[model samples]
Target: MTRDQVLEFVKAHPASFMATVDGGEPRVRAMHTALIEPVGLTFCTGVNKDVHRQLVANPSVELAYWDPKTGVQVRVRGEMEHLDDLDLKKRIVNDVFTFLQPVVEQFGYDVLSLFRLAKGTSIVWRAAQGAAPMEVAEF
Candidate 1:
């Protein structure tokens, strides 16, 4: 698939499993992306959250998005870039993720952390029952 195709797929399937390192161990959690941009994936979390702390300690991360209905999977691996755009935080919380407004109001905007995987190597695969990991897309 082309880069545009990859972005479209990611926009359709924004829910992903994000992997981060804690101490010397690995941790994974479900995350829904706030937006899919030309640059990369965008996500947000609480500053106090383990995921945020882990990313700060070790920026390496892997984000995997899988669509059960489509039987497609996209995995992106790269360093997490901590973003300091307050406008983005407000826009995301107030627009895209309004459900998080209460949390943002309670903990304040500073509690909300923003991250971006602007440039990363992504590998896409289609479910084929027992097929090996095939490279299906490149950005």
Candidate 2:
């Protein structure tokens, strides 16, 4: 897939697993992306969360998306860029995800952290248990 296709694919599959390293160990968990834009992919987490702290200590991460319908998997490796834009954070809580309203109200937004994936190489794997990637795209 081309870069645009990769972005579109990510948008199609918003629920993904993100793996982050903490003190030489890997930690991965399910995460839902807020959006996938030409600029980058946006995700949010609680500031006090371990994923947040792990990322603060080490910005490197890998995100994986699996499409069961087509048996395709995509992995993106990159650095996370922290966004300090209050407007963006507000929109994420107030607009994109109204479900997070209560949490935002409880924590007053300060507990939220926004991150954008940047400068990544995405590899697509298809239909095999241990096969090599079919294509690689840089974003």
Candidate 3:
């Protein structure tokens, strides 16, 4: 698949599983993508969560996505950073809430922690109908 195809697939899918390393073990959790802009993937989590602590200890992480109908899966591995900009945080909140409005009520924005995964890692996409799995290293 092409880079645009991979990005489009990620954009269509909002949720992904994030994996983090703690000591010698690996921990995985379900998370929502706050934004999938051209720069990179953005997400948010509570600062008190274990994943947050794990990221603080080691910024390396992996995110995975799967589509049952299409028999396609994508894995993204990269370095992560905790974003401190208030404006960026607001944009993420607005974007996420806009998509989630159907299931919840609109309340004032809260201080949700935001993080950006650096694009210099790699993305692997696999599909049953494709010639071979595609590996994209975002340098």
Task: State which candidate has the highest TM-score.
Answer: 2
TM-score of every candidate: 0.91, 0.93, 0.79
lDDT-superior candidate, 1 or 3: 1
Predicted candidate 3, C-alpha RMSD: 3.9
lDDT of each: 0.86, 0.89, 0.74
Question: In each prediction, how many residue pairs overlap at the backbone (N, C-alpha, C within less than 3 A)?
Answer: 0, 0, 0
For model 2, the run of ten residues with the poorest summed lDDT = 128-137
Q: Which stretches of candidate 2 lie over 4 Å from their true place?
A: 128-133
Deviation of model 3 at 113, angstroms: 1.8
**Cα lDDT for residue 119, model 1?**
75
Model 2 agreement with the true structure over 1-139: per-residue lDDT tens digits = 7778888999899998999998999999999999788888899989989999988889998999999998999899899998898899898888788888998888788889989996789989988646763788786
Backbone steric clashes in candidate 3, count: 0
In terms of lDDT, model 3 sits at 0.74
lDDT: the better of candidates 2 and 3: 2
Cα error, residue 9 of model 3, in Å, equals: 1.0
C-alpha lDDT (0 to 100) for residue 5 of candidate 2:
88
Q: Please write out the lDDT profile of model 3 over residues 42-130, one tens digit for every residue.
A: 88776667888898889898898888777778788878988877677666556665553432234433435678875755566557647
